[model samples]
Target: MTKVAVLGAGSWGTALAAVLASNGHDCTLWSRRTEQAEEIAEKHTNEQYLPGAVLPDTLKADHNLARAVSGASIIVMAVPTKGIRKVCRDLNSVLEGPVLFAHVSKGIEPDTHKRISEVMEEELDREICQGIVVLSGPSHAEEVIRNQPTTVTVAAKNTEHARRVQDLFMNQSFRVYTNDDVVGVEIGGALKNIIALAAGVTDGLGYGDNAKAALITRGLAEITRLGVAMGANPLTFSGLSGLGDLIVTCTSVHSRNWRAGNMLGKGKSLDEVLDSMGMVVEGVRTTKAAHQLSKECGVPMPITEALYAVLFEGQKPIDRVELLMGRMKKNETEDLAGWS
Candidate 1:
């Protein structure tokens, strides 16, 4: 069994640690809070994050970062995008040799506009890092904790690294697929949160299924357009990390981004919405990065533009929706052709 360290005690991180432990690996989950770590280690429950669920008996927890990763062969980075660099710096100070990293966070860094893997590679010392892998898809933490059947994709520049992650996480209830398109996988995983938030807004506005269907379809188009522009395989957007993640995050009540968007659609201030949702809404941050990317890449992301206005430009959500609906028409086929 592999010695695995999962950094982060959030719902996703805790649930993944349970999976690793259930697979008979020596998995240790690290939480910044000492009390939370003690409670999880002794009580076998992370009540705040994974309420009503009991973690695996073998799963351990640690408040100390260095102790958690000591002798670990694989490090599962489940922290939010914003904390990645700090965590990498900490790991660099303590780590002794090259270790494989599989980051589950999905977001594009604003200003720098780098993917999570890029940020990790930049922050982590070259000699101590073996490679970077991304594991992402439509699976939600709530469902995964219940052992509900879920499938996700792991992508990396090295096919061997991707396969290793696949083997580590794959099980009867949790299926893992391997992909080599790191750019497409990362882009799809990061951008779906943006679409999910928009979808939540539509739901809040009481827009019916037709509006949502159109938004999702067009959102996929925008994602595909931008992904292709960023040197990613367009076909990857159709796979689990792309269209699949978009559908689940946009439609599911379990999605934090959707919930935050729903609050915005119902007329809550962005500050208020963020305050209420204790978890990080990746979509909110990703929207800003995607908007910037659209400008830089010369890609027309009307939905992203509309959402950006609502999110940052002080425009009402409904007004932005109207603006989106009122935009001049374009040939759908012609738009798809532009992605090439």
Candidate 2:
């Protein structure tokens, strides 16, 4: 049994910790709040984030950072993107030895435009971090905790490390795949949330499937364009992290981004939508970073730009939809011609 420490007590972290514990690994989940830690340990349920889901009894919880990571050989970071750097720094300060790190957060740093793994690398000491791996795809925490069949990919610059993570998480109900295209995986996972938000808006606006389908398709195009310019393989955009993730996040009620966008489309202000959700909608922050990235990379992301206006400039969601639909005509495959 491998020793694992999953940082953060959110739904994703708790679900992953349950997976590890069920695999007979020595796993501990760390929560910043002592009450949360006690609740998880004694009750085996993180109702705040994952209501009605019971965690594995063998799984342990701790509020102390040092205690949670004391003897762990693998550290799973499931905190939000904004918390990644601080968690990495905290882990580095307390870690006694180098450990493999796997992150499940999907987001782009607002100002730095760094992926979650990048943020980890920047904050973690090399001496304490053996490798960085990103675990992502279409999987949802609610389904995962229920032992539902789920597939996900783990990527890293170090193929060996990626394989190690694949083994650590793979089980009959949960399938794990490995990839060396870290850039593609990270980019696909992060940007899909933006598209999901737009998709949600479409639903809230009472638009039909046609509009949602168009958003998903065009969203993939722009995401691939930006990802390719950033040194990722274009083909990876068609894989689990890309198309697969987009389909699920854009349609599922579990997606916070989609739900938030739905509220916006239904006439709720951005502040009201955010205030009601009470969860970190990664897409809201990612939209800002993605808007900046598109401009910086010279990629035309009309959907992202429209969403940005509605989200930040106080433009009406209906107007944003009009803006997108009324754009000048261009060859759909023109941008993809060079890819082939």
Candidate 3:
């Protein structure tokens, strides 16, 4: 049994801590809210996020970062992408020993457009880090918490690290695949939220399957383009991290990004959506970042660009869809891989 510390106590974090503890690993879930931590420790439940699911009695919460990670061999980061840097900034100073880090959050940073792993690298630096791994795929925390069968990927620069993560989390109802495509995994995991929002917009606009399919297809195109330009294995885009993740995020009702986008498509303003959700809709922030990155890299991400306009520029969602539908046609695979 591995000793695992999950750094976030949100739905995903608690769900994964349950995964570890249920598998007989020593799991400590940490949360910023002391009362919430106390509640989880006492009740073995997180009513705020994972309702109707009883956490393993052994799964506990610790407010102390050092205590949370003391002898743990694996540290899972399930915090939102925006806070990853800060989490690492605090974590680097007091981490007792080197441990494998598996970041499960999705979303690129604004302005920098750095992936989660890259941000972790910047915070901890390579010399201080033991290993970096990413856990991602179509798996949703709601389903995973219910012990549903779900598939995910473990990605790292070293295949060994990937394998280690896979071994750590694999179980009867949960399947973990290992891959070395860190860039593709990170980028695919991050960018799909954007397309998921777009998919939601399609649904909200009352557009049918054809529109959603086209959005998914083109979104994958631009995502792969940026991933290839950034040194990811092109094939990984077709795997669990890329295509698999995109499909799940775009289609799942549990997806916050898609839901937020659907709200926007249904006539709510961005502020209204944010006020109502009160959670990190990673895709909205990520859409802005992707728009900036595509411009910097000269990658044509028309869908992302259009979404950005709607979110930030106050463009009408319907008009954006109209424009996307009227765009000029091109070959399915033409210059899409960034081979030039």
Off by over 4 Å in 1: none
Q: How many angstroms is residue 39 displaced in model 2 relative to the true structure, after the best TM-score fit?
A: 0.9
Tell me the deviation in Å of residue 157 in model 3.
1.3
Clashes of each: 0, 0, 0
Q: What are the models' TM-scores?
A: 0.99, 0.99, 0.96
Alpha-carbon deviation at 140 in model 2, angstroms: 0.9
**Which tens-of-lDDT digit does each residue in 1-340 have in candidate 2?**
9999999999889988999999999999999999999999999889899999888999999999999999999999998898888888787779999999999999999989888888888899999999999999998899999999999999999999999999999999999999889999999999999999999999999999999998999999989999998889998889999999999999999898899999999999999998999889999999999999998888889999999999999999999888788989899889898565
Q: Could you tell me which 10 consecutive residues in candidate 1 have the lowest summed lDDT? A: 331-340
What CA RMSD would candidate 1 show?
0.7
Which candidate, 1 or 2, has the higher lDDT? Answer: 1
- Report the poorest 10 consecutive residues by lDDT, candidate 2: 331-340
> What lDDT does model 2 reach?
0.92
Where model 2 places Cα greater than 4 Å from the true spot, the runs are: none
Question: Which candidate number maximizes lDDT?
Answer: 1
Per-residue error for 42 in candidate 1, Å, reads 0.8
Off by over 4 Å in 3: 125-128, 335-340
Superposition error at 107 for model 3 (Å): 1.6
Clashing pairs in 3: none
- Rate residue 75 of model 3 by lDDT: 90
